[model samples]
Target: MAAKMKGAQILVECLKREGVEVAFGIPGGANLPTFDALYNSPIKVILTAHEQGAAHMADGYARATGKVGVCLATSGPGATNLVTGIATAFMDSIPVVAITGQVRTSVIGNDAFQEADTIGITRPITKHSYLVKDVRDMARVVREAFYIASTGRPGPVLIDLPVDSTVAETEFIYPEQINIRGYRIQASPLIDRAAIHRAAEAIAQSKQPIIYAGAGVIHGTAFAELLELAHKTHIPVTTSLLGLGGFPETDSLSLGMLGMHGFEYTNYAVAQCDLLIGIGARFDDRVTGKPDEFARRAKKIHVDVDPSSINKTVVVDYPIIGDVKQVLQELNRIVQAPDTRAWLATIQKMRQEYPLLYREKEKLLPQFIIQEISELTKGNAVVATGVGQHQMWTAQFYQFNRPRSMITSGGLGTMGFGLPAAIGAQFGRPDAVVWDIDGDGSFQMTTQELATASKHKLPIKVAIMNNQHHGMVRQWQDLFYQGRHAQSEINPVDFVRLAEAYGCVGIRVEKKDDVRPAIERAMAITDRPTVMDFVVEETEDCWPMIAPGKPHDQMLGTYETLKQAGGVPQHRRSDPDEEAKLSLG
Candidate 1:
């Protein structure tokens, strides 16, 4: 049945059909008609203070709920403001759809107010983009946008609607099927059985095998399959930063995280493994210190849906291009547990030798704060973080037992992502506890979103590690730049009062003893948002860092710590050849 309606009305109706229960955005002259249509619709609209915050909120919602998140904005400045957030989602492969309202079609090129090339600006960051000049094309574009955003290698999609199109009248008929030429989602069942068998054979032959999983494991919903494959094969597991919760960190085989700042023993295990099974993980530079030196002794097997990712960095012996879950399912059926007794013993020894530890001081520490949160929440809360020292600390200390429990800007390392992401996570899982463990420098970037959280009464607890400096930047300068403290030092702001101004509860803790009580009080507030300022040591650095371009085994902080603790192994003090021999055996 066809009925006459404005394009704005059709847009709202199409969103309803796509199961969009909530949208985040702001209104302007170009988007007023869409806002007017939303006024009468059943969908909940959250008015964000800025367009960037709205985009991040949508990203957070999608990551938390595994749904295609939606955000709207006007064409010019509004569309431009979403660039950083869109890039964040694209780098991390989060499914989000951003809609922007443009000027009238006739005035699009006339330099009219609030007119920008929305499609041109967003093409690089989005999976697909559309511009709707005709009112009748609204339904099809919306359908395609959602489809593209949520499909294979999920990323963001953009839809640009002109003001004239929104006001124009047309008979609406939403498409029941999508028929985009040259666009195909790889079927999960069409896996190569021969390749799976070959991978299984390789697994059987290897003495020390490591499973390096990534966000794709979570995105493909292969958590159970990954666990089964690991358990069946008795392989130790390490993950990229975004892949933290793909395998339970509390498991015996779990190696926390493996990267530049990963656990010292995880990197050592990766260095000495005979076989590397990469599941949905790209060999990012952070994870693979020097690509040529990464897993030099290991035969690599990479499994991913995107074919281009295979051998894009480190060459692989066996590349299986299929869904992670499907490939793992088939592999689990044929795989047998390898004799990794010696390998597990070696890894356990390394773990015991170089554990994650920080100096106990009278002043508060970020690591202690994160440990408290993880203990209080039983490692079940949806933990979000901004990029910095705090982000790495959360990845290291927090025990994530489930997927989608850790949300952050991994690929882009975008600052100011924590608070808005927490807001979105709270909305997606209303009954669950959400925490934003943020740094002072990163939190100040998008701290205005506290208003949105307060207005909605989202019980998202924010723990600010107020170190009064750009912690990571300071660390780098200290290590690489002769301790010249540049503009990294941040002026102190009263975060407690700031939280109060936003209509939320605020608490500040200055001593180590107050950390647990502050967290407990924040946890007690179940109505509105609560911000806690824990003034931590200003000069602490994230340890066990592998300098850029260095091999994974050549970690800096661990050797010093181990030497100080009188636990430095005889092999660690030897040359690379001796270390490899000891680690390999």
Candidate 2:
């Protein structure tokens, strides 16, 4: 049975069938028909301040809720605005379906107003793309877009719907199942049993085994499985930036984050481990740090759903391609605990020697603010961040105890991602407390979203680490550019006034004692959004940095105590490599 309906109506019906509760976007002339269809629908539409914000909002919703997030835009500029957000999702493997309105099918290529090659432009960034030319194809395209976006590695998908198709009538028959040729997702039962056994054997045999987890664990909903495997094996765990909440940081076996700005001991563990079990983790350059030297002594076993990711970067001894949760389940059934008492002792010693620390200055520090927020929230809030020094500080300081708790721009490092992302996260988890720990530079990038938050009366708290300059850029200039200030210095703005103008509560804290009170005030306000601008020390830099192309063991700024006490392991101490000569300051 089929019902004749306009293409736009059919598209909304398809969305309803897919169980979409909400969408984020702004309406434009080309998408008027689709907007009209949405007007009478059950789904709620969040009209964003900008298309880019809409895309990030969708991404944030997906990351927070583990659902395929949806966003809509018109052709040309509206479509172009989504590029950065789409790319961010693609890089981080967030599931998002971006629908764009194109010109009429008759005038698509004839220099029509607001027409752009949406499909061609987004092909590289999207997992898949479609241009619906006929009303009959509208339902199928929407179905395929959602299917592709939510399956496999899970990335963004784009559908460019021509305006004429929205007006055209079609016999709508939403497909109950999708069967795309040459497209197959590796299901749990189909996982290779032999590889799972082999990986288990390797884990059991290793004396110093480490579980290097990534965002894949979160995406595959395998945090419990990952926990089971680690506890069963008695192996220590270290995660990539995006992998923070995949394992509880409070666990004794946890090594926190292990990368550029990761804990000093976590990097040491990576250097010393004999077996590296990378479950749902890509050995990214950020984590690997000088590929040849990364885990030089460790035999690697990589488990991923995508086959191409295996041997795509650093080659591994055992490659198992399967869903992370399923693979971990199989491994847990047969895996035996290794004798890791001595290894754990060594890591504990390292942890004690080089704990994350910042100088106790008279001026407020970003690390203290993050720790305060973590304590005030009881480590149970959904925290999002924009890229820069503040981002790393949050990663270093915030104690994440649950999955999907830390939303950030990891692979893409997109500035201005926090405000919109926080707004989206609030929508996805309406009851959960959401906070955006953003740098001043990053906050200014998408501060306009504050209006959107106020419009919806979403109670998302924002803490701005106002360092008066592009903190990370300034740090790099100090280290590599001979201390030239360059143009990193940003002129100050009254964020308090700006927030009030957006119809939100605003607070500013400039002293050490004012930090906690300001945060408490913001936290108390649950009726609407709140912004706290803490004017921090201008020259404070994120420490324990591993310079580019340097080995993780050659990290700079291992607090003076480690040097004076000679507590750093002999092997883990920085060698006199040329790069090591770079200033620790």
Candidate 3:
């Protein structure tokens, strides 16, 4: 332990102890002392274009590597700018440690220059927050923040250090173990035999079963356990948006994403299953459109580390609260494979009958572009996305085979998250090919980060699907608003010029023939990030659609979708047995 160390020096040392190799942030007046300390530290600090970008980059790094990402910022607006990024991480359960500089402790209430109530401002968004008043507590605070951020049900934790304390000398002693009284960091790894037995009994009795997985499985590194359980039971799997890559999408049991814009058969399987085993998944409202109608026939067994998420949305007949990997290990040990050939046959029939379809087009389609990218990458890339149509396309088409291969803002659905996130992903996994699949509007929001990546020589690939409008909102208008375009349209910017301005090589892929060659060229460039502007069909809609205010089964894709809404053909609704099936009894 150092006999005398400044608060800033202590913070840097604590970060080194936490094994943080790289952090993202922009330094300002209030955080200068901390930045000065960072200069002499072993950890590499990436100065971003903006604080929001820094927060998102940290989140991306954390999500990509399954490590607690670190970010730094100054007071007032600098701290405030991090609110959106923090909220995004909190919503998605990404682990991050956000450090912000504050005003002097004496003038905190007086609103000194660049002063802000950082802890209070970020309180709602963070898993935990602290306002450091004493220099002696600096090391302990940093250790605690990392501990909380990376523990069970990980999310962002914030620590606000006053500028006064940053320069104050203190005896440095890092805490070996945290003793937060009310917090339980680890769920008991001991298998509950009774719970395992009950779950096994339920599975044994179930004629039809479906596994609904989410991001927690990936966070817990329980994909192997999940896969084993699925294979042993011969059950099919459907994942939430964030859960992409948690299961091998190329597997026969895999049913891609199950929510709005999900596969028709996947939604049907979820709705019709006698037992829906939700592994590390919350029944999010987005996943369960018309909550009462979602998976009504299923007797759900929900497994999650967070107790609050269980039974919060859809009803659960059985709740298992523990680490996903641990719980899954127990379930796999006790449960035997049931004869689900008949149920699987029915699902396979549905899958073949009503597969996802898109019209062949002469104009370049965003879906086609994304699908091609997936094929080229072969599910090996660390793919990130900005929210909107592009995000959905990436989620649907890309076959994510490994954990941490797919990164997106699932819960918050933040626009402008892709480019910066890809930068972070590239930083964390430099050997992996990192792609930012982005929509024009979303890309425009955080495109300035291109400079940061370019300056740092991060060779990330950015593919912008330029649709000339806010495509998701436009799709909504096209569907429900009598063809009124309304205010969904936005001005188009020349993305090639924009990329060049940021010192990045820009490729324009307007024709189908150019797309592959352009991608190859971009992949070959290892010196700096590459941007590709794909001007896609202006109003192309994402298919396998579940319209708003409708059940997941009420899909509208092809003419086949109209054939059945409630299990029976639309024309055979009056049939007594078919009607019974429709009633979901």
Candidate 4:
């Protein structure tokens, strides 16, 4: 018997068929029917304080679970609120399905209230988007949205469902399969023996070779193969910002993050390497620095699922289009370890000579405080960071040992992402200790989320790296703009007092030695949320920066003039000779 159902009911059914167990969002007038339909379904709905928070939560969920994160919101303000989160997910290539309720189809073009053009607004950000005008097409549209979001270079997809359409009766027949004539996800077959042979040969011949992994490593679940490859080849590994947690940063072979704000040794190794094997990573601007000059000396073999990414910006010697897990497994079977002892020795020397420096002074520096907290927490706590200096420092210093241990807005780098995201992360892992590493500048942007955490009784430890200025922007000004600090300072508030007002346990730390005691005390008290305001040095900057539009190896900060000058490596700086070796183009 053919049964009739509301478009909203069909949407839920389609989602369920796609194995979506939970959706995060907030309800408003235009999206009432979708909320009503969710009441009877098995799919769980998590209500967030703001739509933007809900979208980010979904983005985080998708990043964590490797499934398409779904978020729902009403039209206009609600939909618009999800824009930042949506754009962030898009920039990161995270799989997310953003469903926004719209005004009635009849009034869509009539200047109605809460009637924003979500499709038009979100087109550039989302992988694809749709406007559901006909109720009968609801099931089909939803299925397509989920498919598109999960496949290829994954990203967010927006579906604007009109309120009137949600209630309209439609035949509910979930399609058994999806067929689109124009849409195709291209991937190479694993049976290509020649390509595999060449990749293996590339591995065996190079002396100074490293494996660079990205967020795609996590998405493709290639961590095991990556680890195996690293072990088999005895190669040092470095990751991009999104690539954190894909490998245990504490591992001896792990070089940590490599970028403008990455470790001194990591960026140096990228510059000096003769060969670079990038798995599940796009050579993005942040990672590559200058497209023409990035990895100039290294012969690169890029293994990614997306073909379009191959040699798009940076030149790739070998581009393998397949899932990273599959390609790495194949390469592992064919490749033998190159004698990298000399190479490893060089890297070790570089690491030992120019270690990540956090200056020790009478007053506290944020890095020292974060490192102390990390040590105190024993790497068990989940660190969530807002954008800028605090985020880079946390990524640099914190030894993330497990998957999803570090959550930050890496791709879009949305400031004020700390408090609400920390709350959402706490919910995701209720048993794990959660810490919000925020800068005072970024923290003030979403300080209101303190209320959300306190209201829900989420035991999130917020450690404000309370530098009274926007540290990252200030660093740029100091280095490139001749120290003319503009609009970076803010009248700092008493974060402890603010936390206290929100019914949270608060502590203030101004001295270097007080950091550990404060964190230990906060960790001991788990009954409510805790905030530790750490008054830190304001002028400190993230070093090893490859000046904007320069090569990845061309760092603006300290670099050795000679190969062993001060026992430091030469590739750490953006010398023209180093650029001549790496063939990015």
Candidate 5:
């Protein structure tokens, strides 16, 4: 029998019924009733210092566990703080349900104390949003929020609850059946036979074909199907940054990450292919460079669950609107693959010629550190990254062997995303090794999350590439503005001390030799979190950069480092323990 309960109680009970065991959030005046409801609940609530961090934690948890992440925030300032993190999840198509408290329903539009327009503010970024004025609507809204967030083309969903409505009495009837009008949320589409056949025919006939996969492949849990398709056809695969772990990076068919900071050969393959099969990937500017010039030689075949994303950017010759897994499964059965021995030879030669190598000096290079970490973990660790140079280095260097292993802020490029995300991932996959590779500038943005992790006893590892500048911004200034680096130089902060203050074990590596040992030591610890501060090269820049509006083939620094190497040791620094003052990282 349904019993009388407050709306907040019904909301919590609904979440419990939805199988939410953990939540990340902060409590405030507007959410006191919900907090009171949560007091006796079985759910584990992690209170983060900032609402943004809480949102990211939820997103990371969602990505790692293949479930919707939940975060709570009070109205006004707290809700506003969640916007960036919400946008980040939305852009990446992560499943997250963000619940924000609002002012009393009676004073919602009167500009009451601690009131802001959360529904209006979040409408643009969320897949769907709700303004719950009626207390009875709470249970249904929570169910809808999770359903919308986790299905179709997964994205963030928002719920704005008035304080008064939440505290009001309601008959608790957690909806076992939901009927949302005009909204169909399912994994697979109504399979179109003709479109699948045509896509298959195009694949069979093409001499030079490339499979470009994206995050959708991960979301669909279709990596096996993707690998089967690739293996059966013997097609070389290249991935977007978000798609890194979608295909096995160590496989012979793998061409690594493709785009602005992508492997040069991968871009070449995408541009020169006779057939470009974009599976579950929107051709973002970073991938396409200039839409008009991108894949000019290819007859494009685009497959996506979202109809709007098809031909929204780069026009497609054949568009298939369906779940990527379902489409690939059908395609594999009906189609015949090709022998790309000649194509493989061509790509191999390009790969050998245009390798990703930096002009190394005595000082420790951030890229090398990432490579070492990858080797130590054997591509088994769940790695997350903050934006900028460190983020790029992690993508370029760390070879992910499985889907959902690499998590970063791809679409929104949110700074301070790494550490908090690592915390969330650790919670989601408690047995998996989780690491946050962060830039100094980005790490400081959510450094306070370390305290949260410490309190929860989450054994997350953080590696901060301390390159004393906003690395990516400084890189652009160095190249485009003729070295006029304004305000990019960051004020120095001792991250080691900061971590210690937050009750985390801290390690600092000033020498190239100490990086491996330090990382190993951190991995050995099982009781708490640890932060590694590596004071890396200050002037090193991420290369293979496609300047804005430029074509993929027109990246500026390609092959320059290879020419400079000439056959000597790739990295040569004056002293083993010297600072990274006069070297490339």
Candidate 6:
């Protein structure tokens, strides 16, 4: 006789079989059966204050662990809340499994209380989705969800379970593996050998060559392979926002980040290079700036698991439809060693000439403040950011040495992401330092999370970059709309005082020198969460910007913009311990 199992029990068993150790969600009536199933499960269930928080937490976890981050939610609002998070994970190609409850099967189309067609709502964002109409299919669907989520070009997948279905009885037999006929994740070994040889020849013959990398490296777990390739070829590398930590920022060849807010030298090098090798990066309008003018001087070699991404925006001379790690390994084996000293030297000179700079004035800029905090944290802390100028600044400045060290609402560009995400990151890693880097306008979106943090006694540090406006939108208005900063201004709040109301510590930094000291003090005080407010430069903008639809080479170089501002820090000062002067090549 076979043992009986509830739908939820079978779901848990399936997740366990898939090796999932954590599930993030908020409990509700529609999900009660599933929550009951989780009561005694080995997989840890982290309760987030909001469903959105649960989704982002799962996203951060996936990014850090290279596993499928799982999020659970009830019907209606709970399900809807996961949209932004799902979209974020999708845009970044992070693996996620979002499980949502639906109304009873009888009431699904009738629009019963708290009912929403989560599958339909999420169809556009998720890689795939399913609504389990049968209890017997639960285990198989769960298994397939994991397979789809973790396979090639990983992304978010959804499984919608109705409340009644969760209470239904079924035999619990977890499948050991999944075999989908139409889903083929593995790249074929029989790629165009001639094209590969041509790519190798181009690299060998080029006097200047660079690799433009994207989030694909992180998704494929190919960072080590990428490093090996870059080191072997002696090619300088630049990354997209999602591609942070794809290469070590501390490495000599790493050109920080590239795109709308990229390193000036990185953009210039792409423009000046004879050969441009793109690895897993999409030629996004922000990254490419002027697509027609991007890398105009260079011959392009594009390697990606998704063939559609090749030559979609920017034309490529050579295309390889293979996995990044596999393609790089093959290229390394086939390519002859070339004399790239001149190219490497040119990059080194550019790095020295136009390094990332945030000037050290009496008052510290938000970028400088975040970099200092990141440095002090030693890449061990998990930093979350709200979407805006500060988010871009954090991506540009923070030298993340570890995976999942930095979490922001990258895809959806959602405001109010930091506080809740920090809450999630802290819950996910209790011993790890967690900082919520937020802006005044964005912080208000989820300020209620401070109450949750206080209730849980989670010691999260909230850094408010108070610029008195919606900085990014304001930046756009300033650039294109003749400085019409309509509806962007927000009344400043005494963040320190606000934290007191939430039973947390709050410190205000009015001066530049006070930024680091405030952070140190907050780090020292471990009793409760703390909020620090910094008054940053109101007019400071992220440099090396690639105006929309522009090519990679047409980027706003630091010399023409950032250096001209005279506020960026130099990176090559004699005193390695202090802020370097900002320079323009």
lDDT at 385 for candidate 4? 85
Clashing pairs in 1: none
The lDDT for every candidate, in the order shown, is 0.90, 0.89, 0.86, 0.82, 0.88, 0.80
The ten-residue window of minimal lDDT in model 5 covers 572-581
**What RMSD, rounded to one decimal, does every model reach?**
4.3, 5.6, 5.6, 5.3, 5.3, 3.4
Q: Which stretches of candidate 1 lie over 4 Å from their true place?
A: 562-585
Candidate 3 ranges with C-alpha deviation above 4 Å = 189-191, 558-585
Residue-wise C-alpha lDDT for candidate 3, range 54-129, written one tens digit per residue: 9999999999999988889999989999999999999999999999989889889897888878888888999999
Candidate with more favorable, higher lDDT: 3 or 5: 5
Model 4 weakest 10-residue run by lDDT: 572-581
**What tens digits encode model 5's per-residue C-alpha lDDT throughout 444-473?**
899889988999888899999999999999
Model 4 lDDT, full chain set? 0.82
lDDT of 2 by residue, 385-426 (tens): 999999998888888879999999998899999999999999
Question: Against the hidden reference, what TM-scores do the models get?
Answer: 0.96, 0.96, 0.95, 0.91, 0.96, 0.92
Q: Please give the lDDT score at residue 538 for candidate 2.
A: 94
- Quote the positional error of residue 307 for candidate 2 in Å: 1.2
Model 4: per-residue lDDT, tens digit, 1-585?
A: 569998888888888998988788889999999999999899978777788888877876676557788889999999999999899889888889999999999888888998898999999999999999999888888999999999878999999999988999978888778997777775446445577679889989999999989988887788888888898888888998888888876566778899887877778899889899998888888888888777789999988888888898889898888877778888898899998988887877777666655445567887777778778877778788899999988887777766677778877899877776677667666787989899998888778767767877888999998889999988988877899988988787888888999899989999876787888899998878999999988877776577889766567655443222332232211111322212211
- Number of the candidate with higher lDDT, 4 or 6: 4
For candidate 3, give the lDDT of residue 203: 92
Give the worst 10-residue stretch by lDDT in candidate 6. Answer: 576-585
**Which candidate would rank higher by lDDT, 1 or 2?**
1
Q: Tell me the tens digit of each residue's lDDT in model 1 across 269-311.
A: 9999999999999999999989999999999999988888999
| lDDT, candidate 1, at 560 | 61
How many backbone overlaps does candidate 3 show? 0
The Cα error of candidate 2 at residue 362, in Å, is: 2.6
